[model samples]
Each structure stands twice: as structure tokens, then as C-alpha cells.
Target: MTYSKTWQGFYELLDTVYRTGRPFAARALPIRLGDEEADRAIDLLYQPLRDGEGAVTGIFVGGYDVTEQVRSQAALRDSEDRYRTLLDSLDVGFCILEMKFDEADRAIDYRIAEANPAFARQTGADVAGLWVSEFAPDLERHWFDTYGRVALTGEPIHFENQADVFGRWFDVRALRIGEPAQAKVAVFFSDISDRKRMEEALRVLNASLEAQVAERTAERDQIWQASTDLFCVATLDGRLASLNPAWTTLLGWGEGELLGRPFLDFVHPDDVAATTAAAAGLARGEPQPNFENRYRHRDGSYRWLSWNAVPRNGRIYATVRDVTAVRAQAAALAEVEEALRQSQKMEAVGQLTGGVAHDFNNLLTIIRSSVDFLRRPELPEARKRRYLDAVSDTVDRAAKLTGQLLAFARRQALSPAVFDVGEKVRGVADMVDTVTGARVRVVVAVPDHPCFVRADLSQFETALINMAVNARDAMDGEGTLTLTLTCGTAMPPIRGHAGSQNAFAAISLADTGPGVPPDLIGRIFEPFFTTKEVGRGTGLGLSQVFGFAKQSGGDVDVTSSPGRGATFTLYLPEAPAALEADDRSAAAASVSPIGAGESVLVVEDNIEVGRFCTQILQDLGYRTTWATNAEEALERLGPDGAGFDVVFSDVVMPGMGGLALAHELRRRMPTLPVVLASGYSHVLAQDDAHGFELLHKPYSAEQLGHILRRVTRPGRPRRTA
Candidate 1:
């Protein structure tokens, strides 16, 4: 029989069964009945009837329709596939776990059975089909306990917790998936470690901020209560808003009395205006670091207050201190300074008096003794001449003593002339080597160019000698003295005087000797202030140097260190080098001393000195005329000074001083030579002689004769017949 018309699948099955001599069955096999558009599914079975040899056979089939069942199964599988895909796509992790139980029925461990892709990411590991104990053996027991309880009781749970073994925190939801006997759970979780860490940092920061705020408050309170200076806060309108306890302690005013009142009310009447001005400044946001004013105290007295204040947020924060004691101390210091100056002056005077008495008495002793010896009637000619020479030498010594005193006073007459400082220093170096002894070496250092200064040549040389002698004494005559000359330099501040930026010539003498002691350096220029033994020095050397430097428009400074050495620098204002040639020419053309009956008009206030001066001029081959005063001398000159070749006048005469007389003569007789003589004259000391020749008192007959002869030199401007 052919079943191909009924169902192709059945026909095929029957054919196979017939060929194999077996019966066949089919399930859900599609067939068309009577040419229908849709085919029907059926379950069929085929069996074949076989002969004894099992070769040829006829087949029989059994069948049933199964279209609905097949379709339902397909639909269910499609829905399951979709559910798996949804789980895999979620950000949250999802997994199914099968719990393992021990003999006591307690869930001990779990194996991951099913997982989504997110499960591996959230857990930082792919644990599917692996026991939790195998991967995370150090997992906390609480995890097992919580998940096991949920599975056993079929209870769902939601929690956020750290899994220490995984080093992460999780937000987890777990529920039993089936019957409690199944011991299975479905878990949904997400990694929450970053959220947890941020929360923890915020918590720590909040705690620290609170602690810092409390600490600052405590510190402010401590400073407010403990500070001795008055601390206060005031409004812009000048009312005291708050005050520290220092106010009560310092001004004897209670806090209540001072608060909420205009601060100017406590100010002194004389200081109220100033205090108001200061308040205005503070309101403008100006900081007043040190403003002083007086405040009325509770004791009916006024106290000086110094305020340091700043403005912020329409308020003034101020710190004030009582400065009454400071003011009083400053006044007292002023008085003390005056007293110290007076004491220093008196001490200097005492030293001068002692020195003068000591030196003069010695000189007077020689004179007195020599005069006494000469007074003997039977004195030999040789002895008489020796006594006369001794008297003359003593007089010379007295005059030198007076001159040194006058030099220290800056009251000695000076004849300033321009000369090269380098050449002068070099010249002094030779003498310094001799004065310092053979054991001491002298070094002279000078620049190639000339440095000149206008100063008294004699005084300048004397100052150099004094310094050299001082250096030798300091070295004990066994060290080196370096003389350095620098041109085009500036004066540095010395002895508290201001420095000069003007060009200057610097002459420095450095000595390798035991240096000046720090304590004595300041007073080294004080007259009679010496470190030497009593008979060794007169102590006027450095003093004369100081006076000379000051009077010559310059300064002297010394720098020293103990056990090292000392350097003394003399700074003089630089003069033009153009004067050097003129000085040299003048020095070259100097005249001889022997006079040849030159007429001299002598003006002297003392009759004895007048007579003596005339006699000396007459003996020097100069015809002399005497006048008691400048007027008499002018009258003797007869308005033109015609008869006199030179006017030898005392500088400190009674009226119309020598300087005035010289000016008068220059006006009347411009060609007549004027020679000024003075032992000590204020006019000569303070001002120059206006081109008049100067002859110092106590000058030797040779000196007087020389100056007169030079002024009377023929063919010279002042050398008229």
C-alpha cells in the first residue's frame, strides 16, 4: 500500500520500515489532508510485519497531532532566551548560587551556578561554577551567615557591606529562588567602594574642621585674656565696642565706664583733635601702626597711649600700649645726655689742665734754675752762654707747647696751599722709616696720577709725623707701616659725621702693631688722652691731627681689630691738580733771608713787644718804624704807605685787627707788602690773611729776617724799593 498521498513523512517512514521488516512511529510530523492549505502535525509510529526469513515486510503506523504543544514549547524557549539577554545587559550583577549543607543542615558554603556578564565585573572575578570557598577563602563568615539565612528561610534581603576578601564594598539584594529545600539563591549586587571611600573622607574632614574651629577659638580667648597690651574693637563711629582687661589695668578705668562711649571722651583735651583725626584715618581703611595720644586716667592724670590699629568690615581692631613711662624715660635720657656732654667737657678740661701744668712746670723749672745760675756774679763766659742758650731753648719749648694746644683747639693760624698728596706721602715715608727705627719697614703706595688737596703744608706734615710717631710707639718700633695714597675717592662717614660724595684724596697709614683698644678708640683724639707712660709722650699728637683734619675741610678715621693692626685714614677734599705746577714754581723761586735796609712799619699793642720788634728789624738791616695800633700804623703810612717797604703788624692788636689793616693797605697801597704776625689770633685762625705774608710769633730772628727779605725782593710784585 502507498501512503505518499496522505503524508510524505509517513510514507517515507513506512518505506524504511518495510525495507527493514520493522514498524515505525513519528511525533509532530507535518501532513496535508485532502489538499488543505495548512499542514497538521502528528505523532505516528510504524511497525512492519515480517515473514519467517524477515526479508519482505508490510508496515503499520500509529499517529497523533502535536502542533499546539510544539508551538508552546517554542514560545517558552524564546521568552527564556530574552530573560537571559536582559540579565546579561544589566549594570547590576545577577547570579544564582546553590548552597551546600553539612550534616547538621547548616549552609556551610556555596557554588556559583548561573551568572550574568556583570556578575564577574562587580565581583572583580568570574566565579561561575566555582565554590565561594575556592575563590575567596578569606570571605567573612557574616556573608555566608546572611545569605544562608535568606536561602534557608526563603527570605529576601538588601544590604550594603564590604567584602574584605575582595577588597570591595557591595550593595547586594538576595532572595531564595525556589523551595527552601533547594538551598538556592538569586543575588543582585553593585560595587559601591568609591561611594563608601568618599563618605569616609567627608566624615574625617568634618571632624577635623570642627577641631580646628575649637582650637582657634581657644587660642583667641587665651591671647585676649593674657595679653598686657590693650586689645579693643571699635565701631567706625569711634565708640568702644569691646575691650580687654588690659584697659582697666593700664588706665584704671572699668570696662563698663569705657564701653559704648565715644573713645574721644577719654582722650586728653589737648589730644582730642588728634585722636579724632586718627579715627577718621582708620575709617578710611588706613592702618595706623604707631599713633600716640594721651588718655585721661581714672586717677585724674593723663597717660600716653600708642595705638596700632587696622580696619576690617566697618570695624577697627586696635592694640594700644601705655607710653607715659617711655616718654619720661626719653626726656630723662635727653637730660642724661646733656649731663654726659658736660661731664666729658669737664674731664677734657681737667686733662688739659693737668697736662699743661705738668709740662709747663718742668719747662719753668729749667728756666728758673738757669736764671738762678746766671744770677751768680762769678759765672764763667762759657757757663753764661750755656744758660742763655738754655733759656732760649726753654722759650722755644714753651712756644711749641702753646702751638700744640692751639692746634688741638683748631685755633692755630694756617697757611693753606695746594700740593700733591702722593708726593707728600712719599716724602714723609723716608722720615717715617727713620722715626720708626731700622727694625720697622715703611711702604709707600701711590697711584700713577697726582691727587692734590689745599691744606696747610706745615700742619699736614706735622699731622703725618704725629701719626707716624704714634704708629712707631704702637709697634714698639718693630713693625711695618704702610702708607697708601688714593686719588678720586670719596669720604666715608667717620666719628658719626655724614659722608661726602664729593671727590677726595685719601691718605691711609696702616701699622702692623697691637691695635687700639675698642674702648679707647673714641677718645684717642682727646687732648692728653694717651696710653703711653708718663714721660714718653705729651698725648697731643692725635688731637692735633683731629683738629687739623676738621679745620682743613676733611676728616680722619681709624679702623682696628684687637691683636691684628690698625689703619688711620686722612681724607681731604680733592683740589685741582692744576695748582701743583704753580706751587712748584713758587717753591723754586724762593728768595734769600739777608735784608738790605728795607723799611718796615711795626704795629703792636704791647709797648714792650713793639720796642722788641723794632730792635730785631733794625738789627736784621731793616729800618723800622713803630706804631701802637693799626690807626697809628695807617697814619704813619700817610694814606699810601709810601715810606714802608713792608708793614710788620701784630695780628691781635687792640683795634682794627691785622687782617682789617691788611685789607685797608691793599685798598690804599696795593703794591706794599703786608706781613702778619701772631702767637694766637682769632682772626687769623678763623680766616685767611687775604694774601698777606704771615710771620708767626716766637719766630727766630732768622725766620723774621727771611720773611721780610722775601717780601722785599726786588722786581717781585710786593718787592718794591
Candidate 2:
């Protein structure tokens, strides 16, 4: 074969071998084959072409063709170069591990047979050809077992694990490489340090989110379950969707009973309309900040409920409160206010009446004494008639003024007894008619059943008469006067008296006449406060009625509208069934003239009154001594009152009052009979004249004589000296 330029080096090698007569060798020698575009590889062995000699002549071209083998080797070398480049460029760590085992087939350590550049970067150290225990003495045995198991079982495992030695985390995939007897594992891993940190951060964030969720949920639940007020969620259709336990606690109803039911179901019938209206407002997206209505309880009683509600998202969130007790307290407060008003009114009236009564009584006493003298039959006929007529008119006016004063003062002695008010009203009907006149019609509208009251009979009659007169005057003496008597357990509240819860008799005198003006109605019951002309009225009629009703443990109320009509109602407490009428007729009988020759001491503050008293006593066959005041009377009676069989004294005196004198006389000589007299005195009004024989003022000679006989009667009980 002809050698080409490519074979020149081989030919030179062959020439040398021939000149030295020795063998020649050529490794991976190239040869051109017939001008082909490819080259061939060969490993040549050249020996000297000599027979039985060690000398080499021409090279022995007997070597096998290594072209295919060389090509394959070159290809494999290129591929291995690419693989090393790829491994060095990768972000993952790559290693090949071989497990070392003892004779017992137990693996105790692992060796890294191969490692990539990334593996060194990940571990921060050289690990190839090093034992895992030498690199990290604390490496877990699982690493050895995992490699051994992969080598022995030919199974692949993918896992993530931390290598604390380098404070790094890795995601590793291991598989058996080569034959099972190799006991080697090829592992591909990623240095997940940054990924591990991110994962830990995500875990902490998730944990914080969960904690916040739990905290919010706990707070919401606490508010829902712990509130005492009725917290509820309801639908737009007025149905209760859910309610707190307060529903059951406050309304005496279970939650089950309230939920799913229309909210109006619990409303009282009278309040349903209002509640429905409010619900409509809520449905229209209007919030009810405060709404009140009565709700029926489970026990059938009604309770007042106050609600504050807001509507949103087709539902209502509402808070409710039971206000029944608050309502009751408000009512009680109103009643107390009314009672206070009444008491204040009475107090004001009492002060006014007491202020004028004392002076008016003195004037009346003078008029009465003058009238008594003018009535004597010894006077000339014409003079007697004229003086009697004039005096009689003056006495009438004086008596009326005194009566009014006593009535307004609430000191008119009342004989309160159980009497049928219906009967009393009937008895006074004729009198009321007479006062009202023929122009006015008097109608008595009493119930068939007797309405009995524990009040003074004459005062009740007088009250009726006063009311009648007021009605007649209001009507201008032409309207209908209706006297309606009603009996019931509840009476309207009256000024100056607490409303009685017991049965009461309401005698209302309604007049179809021009009513008193609204402004004057309150003052109508005030003494001397009248709407009539000054000379036409004393203004004490209504005040008398008020005083009498109040003193009798009752009250009077007036309803009037200007230019319309007026009503005067008297409320009297009812009496028990088994009441007996008082016998006042015996007390009204005239006194007997049975005075013996008894000595008397008369005390009077007025000069005329003192002389008249002594003269009357002497004319009644009683030895009399006169004194201008209680002090003089006591002096005349002496310390032991030896000259007096009875002591008579005026109650209201200058130096010492009769009551005080009586007390002093009793202390000095208790056996002396002392009598006290007065037209109107504060002491007599207080019932402080109990120990003495009380005599009213303007007493006649016959009355004085009778009183003296009674006091000086023999064997009568006398106080000891």
C-alpha cells in the first residue's frame, strides 16, 4: 500500500525500526484510505522483517483496525466533557455516594465518590472522596441507610433534608447507578436554603393569620353571647331569624318560641298597629333609634318594650329592653305629683281662711249681741219693729260671713257618721231646687242602690246646697242642674286629698250653664276669690265644699269650660255596711232652767260683754261676779276659789286666754267648775277645750242658766283641789 502524507510519521517510525533491526510500535496512527474524505485509526506493531532474528526490516502492519474503537472513545470523551460542563453550570448539587458496610451487611458510613462544582458550593466544602461521617460527624445514619437501600434495592427516593453541618437545606433525589453490587447511589439535589427560609416565613405568616382569625372570632362570639339586652337578627319580613338568650330571660319565652315567628306576634293587640308601622319603616331602610310598644309575655302579661334597631343586607340588627317597671314608676310619680299639688292648694287656702276668721268673728259677735238686745219686747212698737228689722238684716249678713269663715277654716264641728249619700242627696234635692229657683230644673240622678259614706250629714247637705247655688249662678238661674251620684272603687284624684283606692261615692253636680272661665276655676275654691260681683258673692261656697270634703277624708273636683258647662264632683269615702246613724236630736234639745242659787265668776274681754254676762247670771238666780279678763276672774275666784261655785270665762282675752286661765284655776282649785266660751278661737279649733265645759259665744240668759245648773249640780264629779 502506498503511504500518503498522513502516514509519513508511521513510515518514518518503520524506517527507524528497519535500520535498527528492532520492533516498532505506533499508537492511534492515522491512514488515508484511497482518497476518501474520512481518516482511519490504527494501533500498529512493527518488527524487523528478518528470519529468526530480532532485527526489524519493514514494520509489521498486522495490528487490528482501531478506527471504530477510537471514534467511540472520542465520542464518549466529548459526551463526558459536555456532562461535566453541564454539571458545573447547574444550580443543583450533584453527587455519587458509595456506602461502606461491615461483614454483617450493616452500613455504618457513606463515601462521596463524585461531586459536582455545585455540590462543593452548596456544602461550602470539598466533599468528593470524603466519608459523610468525616465531613459531618453528626450526620444522621439515615443518609447511609438511604444510599445503601437505593444501591441494594435499586429504588429511587426523592426527599428534602437539612444538612446542619453547613446550615443548609437540600432537596435530594437518589437512585442506584451501575450494577447492584456497586453499592453506590447517584444523588441529585438542590440547595434550598433560600426556599427553606421563604417556606418558614410563609408558615409563620399563615400561623399569624390563623391566630388573628381565632381572636376576631372569639371577640365576636363573646359579644353575641354575653350581652344582657335582647340582641336579635331578623329578616326584612318582620320575622325573627335569631335572638340572644335575653329573649328567653326578659320575655319569659324560649328562643325557639321567638325565632322564626313574626315579631308582631308578641306585640299586644293595642300596640300591634304601631309595631307594624314601625316594622314597615324598618323595611323601608329606615332605622328606628327608639320605638316603644307593649309586648305580650309568655305568661299572658304585657310588658313595655323599647327597641333600637338598624336594617341592612335584608336583615335587622336590633337591641330591645323591657321597660315595664319604668312605666309603673312613672305612673306612681304622676300620682305623687298630683297629691302634692292638692296638699299645697289646701295649705294655701287654710292660711288665707285662718288670717281673716279671727277679726270677722269679733265683728259678728258685736252684731249678734246688738241684735239680741233689739229683739226685746219692752221697746215701743214702731221703734221696736224698725230697729228689729234693721238689726235682723245686719245679723243675717254677719251670720253668713261667720259661717263662711268657719267653713273655709275647716273648723266647723262636723258630726261624721255613716249615712246614705243617695238618701242625703234626695233629702237636699228640694232645698237645691228652692235655691236654684223655678227657672232652673234640678235633676237627681242617683243609683237605686244606696251610696253610703262616713261623713257629716249636715255638711254633706250643705255641700250639695253650695254646689247647687254655684250651678244656678253659673247658669244665670235658668239651666238644668244634674245631681249624679255614682259609687265605685276608684275615684278621680282630688286636690288637697290623696286619691282613695277604696270604694267612693261620687256626687257630681253638672250644670248646663255658662261655665266659669278656665283661669278662674282654680281660684273658685279659694276664700274670697270669686268671679261674681263683690257684693253679690262671699266666694266661700266652693271653698266650703272643698274644706268639708277634705276634712271628711274625701275631696272635691271641678270641671269647667268657659261658655259651655261646669261640673262639681264630691268624692267621699264609702262607709262599712253595719253603720248606725248618730242621734243629734237629743243634743239639739233646749237646755232646762234648773240653776239653783249658785255663785258664778264671769270673765269677758269686752266691757259690754262682761256686764251683760254678769247681769244674765244674776237674773238666772245665780250669784255673779264680773271681770274684764281671765286674770281678773281668777283673782275674784281667789286661790281656793272659795266664793265661786262655777267659773265662766271668754276664751279669747287680752292678758290670759280662757283655756290658760282654766288650766291655772284647775291647778289652784280643781274643784271650781270652769266653763270656756268663744265664737272662734284657735284653741277651740284644735279641740284643746276638752277639760272645761265649752260654751259657744252669743249665749242667751237661758243657755247660761242651764249651763250653770249642769256644772253646779250636786254630787257631780269634780276635779280634786
Candidate 1 residue-wise lDDT, 442-483, digit = tens: 989998877889998889988998999999999999988999
lDDT against the true structure, each candidate: 0.79, 0.72
Show pairs that collide, candidate 2: 21-55, 21-56, 22-56, 48-56, 48-57, 49-57, 342-496
Expressed as tens digits, the lDDT of each residue in 671-705 for candidate 2 is: 77888878877656645355577766555566677
Q: How close is candidate 2 to the true structure, as a TM-score?
A: 0.44
Candidate 1: TM-score?
0.61
Error of 2 at 192 (Å): 70
| CA error at residue 321 for candidate 2, angstroms | 21
